[model samples]
Target: MKNEQIVLAQRPEGLPGDETFRYEDTEIKKPDNDEVLIESVYISVDPYMRGRMNDTKSYSKPFEIDEPLNGHVVGKIVESNHENFSEGDVVTGGLPWKKFNTVSSDAVNKVPSTEVPLHLYLSTLGMPGHTAYGGLLEIGKPEEGETVVVSAASGAVGSVVGQIAKIKGAKVVGIAGGDEKVNYLTETLGFDEGIDYKKDNFSEKLAEAVPDGIDVYFENVGGPISDEVFNHLNTFARVPVCGAISSYNSKEDNGPRVQQKLIKSQALMQGFLVAQFQDNAKNASEQLAKWVQEGKIKSEVTIAEGFDQLPEAFRNLFTGDNFGKQVVKVSNSLD
Candidate 1:
């Protein structure tokens, strides 16, 4: 049978442009011993993919030129050579960007028949969820009555971080790119206040939003917003660096100096990779599933239809065009 996929045609210099990717169709053999043939249902589009486009050193190796990009994908088993998995079992795993994948049985994790949708496995109950859980709890360690702030507050990780803070009894503030995202953060996500970074008085507005001074700043969209937030951090504040989506596409490094604040405030700042807490993912997933069931954590997914929309869907992350976890629906079971 034939499978269509998106491959990295060239290493991007700064931000990835359309020229960096190519779509191709090729033939694949049926599943062999201990393998399963999966028809992809949904694929994730995340800011971390931007780092993979560069040939520099990172947590994961850069994608080889001319190879298919890989990310979290949810699919159903159409053919199986293992006893544990059967036809029609929905699964999630790190799969190549393709219409179908032939993977070893050990490569994928079986999804439970929960009330949460399968797409949640690639978003809220998946890596981004764990990123928020481990980073905030382990690093930020926000306490009740403390002020907690997060950037990219409308995004998958930041949205979850803010809500988790609120659940912990902390006053939560959010910062997003535009008014729409700001509204979503304050209104839908239950943040106490939301700041639009696009506003002319962003720094001033951020100051006004957090009157008590930030006790914990969950850093996601770094750059100028991060710089402004740093200045308002209270003494002995904690900053957990999860991601920096705002600077992912920057041609050059730029941000306000924060060394003085770091010294005076005696604050703790740490950057973490999610894989470092792999030992806790299973436990975290279970807890997140419980939260979802109880309506404590709400997931927002922006789905683009078809495999052909992958490139545009990915590009949307850099422009703040996506409202939440951006996913591409490759093939629908409902259809």
Candidate 2:
């Protein structure tokens, strides 16, 4: 069988386009001992992958030019040479964007039997959900009656952060780009308030929403929105720095100094990667899954149709072209 794979053509200088990706056809390799052959089903596209496209140093190694790009992928085992897996087992892992992948079984995790959709393993039930649960609860530490603000509130990570905060009894305010997204935050996700950052009077609206001052800020889209949010921080407030999608494509991200705000509020600001809390992965996943099962948390996703849509789906992360978790459905057979 011939396998189709997507590779990084070149390091991106700015916003990546079709020129950044290349497609190739190759013969599918059978799994060896302790290995499995995975048929790609759902692929996740995230903002952090943008940093990997640049040849810069990051928490994860940069993708080399001409190598097949990889991310969180959900797949089905078509062949297995391992004792732990079978011919039709479902799995997910950081796998290459290919029609078929042959890798050691140790690298992938089997999907638990659940009533939720399989695509969710690449979305809320996967990496993005873990990022939210770990970052917000560990760093943000929101308290009852306190105000919590989440930028990009309708997104995969931010939406979960908002709902979890609400479950903790904190008043949650969500900041998003348009009226439609803002409505999703308040009406659908149960956020206490939603602010449209695209409005010229965003700062004024943000101030009005958090009258008691922000006790926790789940920073996602850092830029002018965060600069304004800082000005509303309560004393001893906590800021969990998760991502900065606004500056992902920029050569340099310049903004107003935040030293004065931090000093005056005596707040704590910390940047974290979900991997840092690996020890708590099981606990976090269990709690998130329970919340989801109880209808306390809802999964929001924008799924693209085919494997060919991967590049466009990835570009959508930067353009805000997608809502919730962005994933591409490579096959329907798994469903």
Candidate 3:
């Protein structure tokens, strides 16, 4: 049967535009022995995809021009030749942006229960959620009553990081782009304080929010926000650098220089790519899932309909136009 796919039309010069990708139809053969055929239900659009658009060296290889773009997908097995996966079983895995995928049975993990929406597996129970859990606990090591700040606090990873910090008894503050996002962070997400970086008095607001000084900075949006947070960090503060969405669309690689602050405060600043902690995902997922079940954490997702909206949904992440995990629903099983 034929499937629709989005291909990397060209390597983006800086930020990707419409010309960078092309949507086309292709045919896929039935599953081979020990393989499964999947129909995608939802696909994730993430900030890290921007880095993959450039033909530069990174922890993950860049998507080659003319190749189908791949990311986390939640799908249902329509055909299976493997013992592990059965037809009609819902699963989650890495798959290209397409209507269907032919993959090895081992590549798909069965969804635990239908009680939780399948789309949740593509966000809170998926790579982005695990990144927040492991990156914060392992790298940030936040303590009770300590002050913690996170940029892009309304986005996927940042939102989860802040909620988890609060669960751990920290005074959590979030930095976001607009008033709507700031409101969601403070009112919905249970953050102690929310600062709108777009405001003229952002730096002053941040200083007021973090009165005790930041003990942990779970940095997602870098550039000036990170610089200002760095300056406010107390001695021995920990900075878990997860992503830099603020600079994803920039032509130049300029960010706030805070080396002196790091030196003076004796803070620990470390960057981490989630893939590096694949071995710990299982443990982290269990913990995060438990927290969700116990009402200790909450997650939000911004969903767009159809696979055709993939490009626009992805662009929204870099533009700071989306709140929480940006996802595209490919099909309506309930309908």
Candidate 4:
């Protein structure tokens, strides 16, 4: 069998394009001892991966030029040389963007069996969901009845953050780009208010949305939207900087200078990686799954069909084309 893999042709100068990726077909490798051959089913595409594409010192290692781009993959074991796993077992973990991956058993884990849909394991019950729960509860520390404003509110992390805040008795205001996303937040997710940041008078509209000022600001996208949010900060607001997708593509740091606002409000601001709260992963997944089952929380995955669509779908992340968690469906033979 031949494995088709997508490799980074070159480091992106700005927003990644077709020129940045290349597809290669190579012979599939047989698993050795302590290894398994995974038939990839689904792969996650995230905004954070954009940082990894850059040749810079960051949280994750930069993608090597001419090598296959790697990410979170949900696959099924086709062959296992390890004692722990067997053929036909569904699992998920860090895997290469290839049809077949021969990886060590330690690099993957069996998917948590649940009545909850399997694809969600790569979305809401996965990194993005945990990122929201950990960043908001731990850093933002939202209190009851206080206003929580989330930038990029329709995104994977921000959407979960908004819903969780509502569950905790806080009024949630979500900032998204369009009216479609704005409606999704208020109508579907139960957010108290939705702000369309692309509006002609966005700053004015945002100011009107959060009359009491922002008590908890889940900072997902950082730019003019956040600059406006900063102006409405309460005396001691909590800001959880989960991501800055707004500036990930730029070599220049165009991030808004919120130092004056931070000083004036004396608000707490912290940047966090989901792995920092590893101890809470299991619990967080369970809670999110429970909420999902009860219909208290709704999850959406904007799937791009076929492995070939991966590059185009990946580009869609920066374009704000996807509504929620974005994943590429590589195969449909789950049975």
Candidate with best lDDT: 2
Candidates in order: C-alpha RMSD to true structure:
1.2, 0.8, 1.2, 1.1
lDDT by residue for model 4 (1-335), tens: 87899999999988998999999998799999999999999998988889899888998899999999999998989999998998988898988899999999999999878466677888788888899999999999999999999988988898999999999999999999899999999999999899898889898888888888899999998877787788899999999999888888877766568788889999899999999999988889889888888888797779888999998888888889998888999988583
Which lDDT tens digits does candidate 3 get at residues 1-335? 77889999998876678999999999986889999999998899888888988888987899988999999988888999999887888898888888999989998899777767667787778888888888889999899999999998988888899999998999999999888999999899999999999999999999999888999999898888787888798999999999988888788867667788888889998999888888988888788788888877787888999989999999888877777889999988533
Among the numbered candidates, top TM-score falls to 2
Global CA lDDT computed for model 3? 0.87
Tens digit of per-residue lDDT, candidate 1, span 1-335: 88898999998876677898999998675899999999899999888998988888988998888899999998989999999999988899999998999999999988875456878888889889999999998899999999999988888899999988988999999988888889888778889999888989998888898888999999998887788899888999999998888788887767777788989999999999899889988888888888888888987889999998998999998888898889999998624
Can you tell me which runs of candidate 3 are displaced by over 4 Å? Answer: none
Please, what is the whole-model Cα lDDT of each candidate in the order they appear?
0.89, 0.92, 0.87, 0.89
Question: Stretches of candidate 4 above 4 Å error?
Answer: none
Measured against the true structure, the TM-scores of the candidates, in listed sequence, are 0.97, 0.99, 0.97, 0.98
Instruction: Sort all candidates by lDDT, best to worst.
Output: 2, 4, 1, 3
Q: Which pairs clash in the backbone of model 1?
A: none
In candidate 2 the C-alpha lDDT for residue 81 amounts to 95
In angstroms, the error of model 2 at 193 is 0.5
Alpha carbon lDDT of residue 269, candidate 3?
A: 88
Local error of candidate 2 at residue 75 (angstroms): 0.7
In candidate 1, residue 176 scores what lDDT? Answer: 88
Tens-digit lDDT string for candidate 2 (263-314) = 9999999999989889999998888888988999986889999889999999
